[model samples]
Target: MKETPLCLTVGHLLPYSMTDFNTTDFTNPSTFILLGIPGLEAAHVWISIPFCTMYAIAILGNSTILFIVKKEPSLHGPMYYFLCMLAVTDLGLSTSMLPKMLSIFWFNSKEISFSACLTQMYFIHCFSVIQSGILVAMALDRYVAICHPLRYSTILTNPIVAKISLAVVLRGGMLALRYPILARQWPYCKTNIIPQPYCTHIAMVNLACADTRISSYYGLFVLFCVMGLDVIFITMSYIQILRVIFSLPTKDARLKTFWTCGSHLFVILAFYIPGLFISLLSRFGQNVLLHFHVLIANVYLLMPLVLNPIIYGVRTKQIRDRLFRLFTHEGA
Candidate 1:
């Protein structure tokens, strides 16, 4: 009888004995180990400090935005409603990863059950997709307000905004729900080690013994159909918005309109660019460094969460004024 050595490779499962591997159950993998930031395991403690800071800011900043929006009657408009939706999605996105990430870094606890990994993957991707949808909804709101001021009120009523938020959640949730289901059915007899800090559909799928072309293609399809289309429509809306802004006779009006959109545009770019880069790199950049992929993925998750509230606070006068008033009142 010959014994086989278990080899752990980057972005792959451990090779098991042929006889034992053939008989191993795929659906019932006792545990999956998460290898956080391959080749930099020694620096994980130092890495966790900045990540923890960003997580704290994400929670506190987004919470403040939600509090101001809910308390300020002046913010009860379509734009702010969309802003609130964005804050909630950012919160969900950060919370989904931070706890597990900290545990891996601080406690060196990397073992995740098969079912738990699937659930985490589902929410991380779902919230991400929903955030993109929220950005699109905000773009449409801006389009109506700037392109057709008179009809803005009637077109984007409270009910309509509510419906839009509901649709965003449903669209993202329904599509992302398929990832975990599909990944679960595949036989994961190879290795149970994920190289990234957290579980992702792509990372998990890559671990399976079965061919995962279908899962890969389906994930790409949803990414383009949902997020790609949202980016396209957002661009179109901004084009029309720019046309409307330039046509205004008064420079003050143009500036005001631009100011209104500044924070959202910043947030949109913050959310989409890193996301697109990571998606592209993961799919096509086989030669790219694994650490680069890990870094960008973390950026994509943390950037929007940390920057959005700050952008809104500094760029939007209403939120800023409310924040100032709240603080001043507390001081007095």
Candidate 2:
């Protein structure tokens, strides 16, 4: 149907809209739907249940690890310290977005004020950077232990680990300040609707009206720099570890060394391969594939946060023995 002049003239009368309007009212979508796993309908309710349950599990799981480590005097070394940091980053990361996302899905609280949206955006970037930094820290710890055992304790002692952790978090927090600033630069005349569960930088860029070259460039730049540096650091650490392991007196010693790094290695590969997959798919895939991409995105983002504690707690002899004794005593 042709748009009549009378209809055009009527739209001019509405305050929320004007002839100057260059974009549609999708700035506030009728529904801020998730491009989630694609079966549609009230299936959204099922999705909310799983996500909320995962949120609770992630929080409790990481908290349990932190609590366990803090309670045990023997678990105060550099390895445990890095594990503690990983748990923290994971919990903070999930807590940063899951609650609000679940609320949006279930309670219909879709209208996030721009300020709140910006706040989420900031923490998301900050926590992600912190997580990457923690991985690098862990890789460095492994490097010291396997490469230079005598100086390992001296190099990764309390003060050094604390300094490293502090530097990573502060640096990430500083870099994250740019996101909200860049976010506000956009007029948002197009649509306020975000496609993903959280306020992602690229998602927000898609909603922008002004030139988004800067935001896109920065987002991709930071993404590559952080993830790329992490991959490089991890690879170098393992290479050194392999060299050191082979130099050891026996195959048994090498096996032990491999076992020591096994959990950390698993978590690293789990997080990265899927992240690369998601980044690739997000760039090229859609519908079912895109839906799958987002699901993997959440899992990869949460993997270290959820898996760190469990991996360390179960794999570390001291932590496991303490928990075993605790349970054994309770049974008595």
Candidate 3:
């Protein structure tokens, strides 16, 4: 029997099998090279022991949020319900990219299978979109609780909230899944080196030799259309919330509102502001601001996973009490 050397594409938007690339010339792919950090120390600097620590703590923290909500039935309402969903999304976000990123950085495991890349892209974008929507849903919950307190329960019942959660997750998932399929349809005639840490859709789009007009349009459409729309709705919801808070005529109420919204605003700014800068830089600056771009990217991606648990959970007394109970409960 004849023997053929195994071929695999490392890390990515679409899972391209070498067998699939047989008809296509991938060896001499065009322009952009991944330019992985040239040295092991360099990769180590980007990802160190702390990276794994942060990643593990992030997963555990977010998982604890879901566990607390489930263990206590008093948390059966819309707020905690949405919180569990947020925790689930946070876990998805962290596990999607962090483990792979840290593996590459720490153990010199830079090589990632093509399918793994696609899967990463799908989950990262899906959870990110859902996170954005969940923030919007939370804002709505606040709005109803404060502005229309009388009708809050009547309006935000379990069935209604659950349906909204389902819709948000489904919509985000569908939006993200589209790209992997789209990428597979196209040929990878360009350089396959992904300069960034993970298989981002934008980076993948940058590698294509075919006319990227559609991909570019779709990227901008998702950003300006979907992401933009989510940001706008969040802003609008908060604006109405502020108006209600101001009208309350009590300092304590206003202060409480500020505290409640503060963590979310922090998360939003952590993810969006830098993300916006990176997006514009990629499109216009030709990756000139690479260092800042990468640093800001970590802020956008990992901060949410770890910070959400600390900011939201620690701030809420119920969560603290629940944690105390979880650990202090009678055990065998």
Model 1 residue pairs with clashes:
14-191
Top candidate when judged by TM-score against the true structure: 1
The C-alpha stretches of model 2 lying farther than 4 A from their native spots are: 1-23, 26-41, 283-290
- Candidate 3 per-residue lDDT, tens place, 1-332, comes to 22112111111111122221123357433333322332233656545565677788888888888888888878788988887888888888888877767666766576665666677777877888888888888878877877788999999998999899999999888888887777666667645666556766766665556675676566667766777788898888888888888887799978987777676677677667766665555456542444444544655577667878887677777888989876787552
Instruction: Report, for every candidate in turn, its global Cα lDDT versus the true structure.
Output: 0.81, 0.69, 0.68
Which one wins on lDDT? 1
lDDT of 1 at 7: 20
Query: TM-score order of candidates, best first?
Result: 1, 2, 3
**Model 2 over residues 1-332: C-alpha lDDT tens digits?**
22111100000100111122233654433333333333232565777877887788788878888888899988889988888888888898899888887776676565676777788878988888877778888889888988998999889879999999899888789878888898777666565545456666666666666787876667656777766777898899999999989988999988998888877787676667766665555445533333444456666666666666677777778878988888899999
Q: Rank by lDDT, descending?
A: 1, 2, 3
Score candidate 1 by TM-score against the native: 0.90
Model 2 TM-score (2 dp): 0.86
lDDT of 1 by residue, 43-93 (tens): 999989999999999999999999999999989999999899889988998
Please count the clashing residue pairs in each candidate, in the order shown. Answer: 1, 2, 5
Winner of 1 and 2 under lDDT: 1
